[model samples]
Target: MKRFPGKTMGLLWASLLVCGGAAAAENFEQCKTRLFNQAVAQGVAKSVATEAFDSINYVERVIELDRSQPEFVTTFPSYYSKRVTDWRINKGRELLKQHQPLLTRLEDEYGIPKHYLLAFWGLETNFGSYKGKMPVLSSLATLACDKRRSRYFTGELMTALKLIEREKLSTDAMVGSWAGAMGHTQFMPSAYYRYATDGDNDGLANLWESIPDALTSAANFLNNLGWEPGFRWGREVVLPQNFDYRQSGYSNRQSVSQWRQAGLTRPGDKTLPDSEVSAYVVVPAGHQGPAFLAYPNFRTIMRWNNSEFYAIAVGKLADQIAGGKGLSASLPDLPAYSRDDIMQLQKTLNSKGFDVGKPDGILGPATRAGIRDYQIANDMVADGFPAKQIMQQLKVVQASETSPN
Candidate 1:
């Protein structure tokens, strides 16, 4: 389910620009001026603050990207196929062997598996081949000045300034994603402060240029996030015919034994291993699609990236790198919805007294619950998937209301 933490920053900024006209730009400049003062108050050198902010322009592109993260809209199958490809897997394997010595050392020290590290490296920036080109300072400043998620981004901006001060990094050299996630494994500035490591012992983390530093920092981050050394991330499991669909998702967690007792098994009907480990069932594409019993380590992966699809991709990619089989089941051919459609759906559900909160175009938990309630009332499968059928049904109802009466 969708979970946007705040209002769309881009839309908020756009509305401000429209309402305030030229005043918006003036207000932004004023905001930047105040940010400079805040930086100085936070112990950033006045010269450093000036230098970082002087030539920085509000990167409109950054706002656009922040608003339209593909993971929010794309189906899991579409997203998964694009990321966990044959080339990536082959490259990951090659890198795994090439960096065996370094990975082995990291595993020994951090108690995290090597393949998972490779998976993160592969997925984050395509094995360091593309760490983005946007200036981190400008992107962070742009986002921090925006109303949405300003508190978080402002703190990140301060941390970035502190990073420059402590690490003695050139602001000009600090290039990364539109949201200011930097380096090979795309660590946010705060994360860089907390977990970045000098793997090569050259007195710098150097996630930009040093593979060892990037990979080591990744391992350290996961380890600090509580990565279990020996346990696998999770495994694809086959549910029993007519199994309860309500038992799926991260909320309905149970021990491995309990799930096995409830008729969950490996894809080939193999018995689950005798373990006391707790896991939750996740059916990303609903009951008709493939299911997985996500282990505790899966939660650890979620700490790295909160998205279920992303966590699954990393785990499955790592599995492939470790010589495991690919997914046996295919994704169902379900019709996709645009953001506007989702917003309309939420609005319609709210009109029907479903209480979907604000129609923010995000299918969050509340929206899903509303959809499920609607489905249950209409005697449909309450999967909360928001498929094309629901959208069409809503459209027909709207048409009826708007027609001559």
Candidate 2:
């Protein structure tokens, strides 16, 4: 899972101890004694636990690392195109050749196909070429100290500490991503506790140093998430003429049979199967672009990352890894509008007695309904999606109404 930025468990506990008055110190001492007395807590040897904690300082540089994600705001094509480039594909192929036996064994054991694993590895760190340079302990501990989501961060921090106590990971060796996600596939502290395994059989699930453990852990995670071995995530679908534009969001789910009845079909196929599985259509742009009928697996991918564009990018990368061509659908010509602009548009519509719902920047169903109402009232095409022209018109109307002649 992509680790959300927040306080770490260590910082939370520390703050509680420091700020909870004299009682806090007493409680801390008691808890420390109890933790130390409990044998085999984090699976680490007892000898290194106190010493590691005593010397480590929660560095503030970790904040910079967490915030420096330049690629997060980029267009999907730009971000994905770079990740799925020939260099990555060739490198992935090379890694596959070198580790075929290990990958084959993992696939057999975990029932997760190898391509998805490769896709994650290739996408995450370019096959471990760049796991991250930050110290996991410092990064996690710093976030924990900040008291941002102290409860959650404290849990993760405790987990990390437990890992240290168990000797499963050496303090010096536990380096990882900016947000404290370690190894090739970027397993966070919580994930390390749950899914990490000793694939190389070195007595520890050392994701930083061992490729086998990282890949195995990743496959284990996906398998546990109900990934189907032979089933595809999604395929491009063709929308019929005069299709309801509002039915393009992620929440729109209909069975394949229902979609067929509604005149939706796969891009190249004429007939739709009468399968009971639910699916939804997403048109990244307006009607001018290619569309897709996303299946349950697509939602699963979103569970890994909340962004629609990110999930689609990962799916595209996985297809590329499997030697399939990139998305055949053309993106809509609509230049992306700023998120702020979208929010402002929603606010305007809501103030005008259109129920845009919550004024969130997301162009969701309620927002679409509001846009449709506005369009109908103005005698414009009720296409639902709020284009630049609609926003401009709203601004002009607002300005005129507010003007002091």
Candidate 3:
């Protein structure tokens, strides 16, 4: 009877797989036909649309990209070190010099500083050396069909079609990131629609071939995102002993006086006289690392990529392009552990009656909050950063609580 049941289950699984494959193929065909008809209705030649759609297949790479995945995630230090190193800095400086007039014009127009623009150039594509190796249409189509983020990817895919229709780009030339972000600055198709500008005035904002378009478009994006003219993003600062960890996160509004009252002080450089603008405090590595008082402009930078590390890396890289020194502080000292170790640590904490959120390997905010709760219960400093010492202590606590004496 058991063998009979196993065979039935195997047949059911095989049938389901076949059905799913057929549905996906059907969906792709429907999407392609709809797109071709729409293009024709909008005056695009039927032959052109047909030719473009003929070879486009649903690419599998887009849905598989999660940097936090086990094979992709890496240490923050290593990540930033490679991206904001001497080579990038030097290249940015050369580009800055080479394109001073255009940079000046962009700065004047958008009020976004030139360094920030060039920094994006360096970071987004390493000065346009490799602007991704994916087909934009296929990638978008695949991700749009993916169950995870279908809505968002489908919207972007439609936006890409609009770009092709407007003659802003040709189908054959729309290669980009597997996630459908294209050109030198990795602008998603929708972003290109909204913020892209023709700084070179060749009638189109061609970020693919024109240097002016990429830099100016980036500046325009920042400007539209609320960058204040003649104002700095944020200055590096030192937190006094016993800084409040709870109050630290990205901020768009905190008066300079308020921060100063809370013991945030910029070392060496005198605080520029701008006391009215709101700012938020950021301490990337808990309490032990260097801190900064991020202004509203900093939040604007964060809008480009909602990661503290990404924003700070861009800010720091911009500073490097502007002939500023490297970071004046270091990261909090913590023993680096792999994903498996962190998962085990989380499980141990959970078994010892401390709810450390899910025992997933990712060390996100909830996990940090749980660890902090555990630390406070055990009379340890609530730094939140995981380390060898904390993991060992957790083990000891778990064993003591679980031992059947």
Best candidate according to lDDT: 1
* Count of residue pairs whose backbone atoms collide, per candidate: 0, 14, 4
Ranking by TM-score: 1, 3, 2
Each candidate structure's TM-score, on Cα atoms with residue i matched to residue i, is 0.88, 0.79, 0.84
What alpha-carbon RMSD in Å does predicted model 1 have with respect to the real structure? 6.7
Against the unseen true structure, what C-alpha lDDT does each candidate score? 0.87, 0.72, 0.78
Name every residue pair that clashes in candidate 3.
253-278, 253-279, 254-278, 254-279
**TM-score of the candidate numbered 2?**
0.79
Error of 1 at 229 (Å): 2.0
lDDT of 1 by residue, 170-252 (tens): 88789999999999999999999999999998998888989999999999999999999999999999988867666667788
Report the C-alpha lDDT of model 3 over 182-213, residue by residue, as the tens digit: 89999998889999888887888888888988
> Judged by TM-score relative to the true structure, which candidate is superior, 1 or 3?
1
Candidate 3 TM-score, C-alpha based: 0.84
lDDT of 2 by residue, 237-297 (tens): 8888878766766667888899999998866666777888888887654456667788887
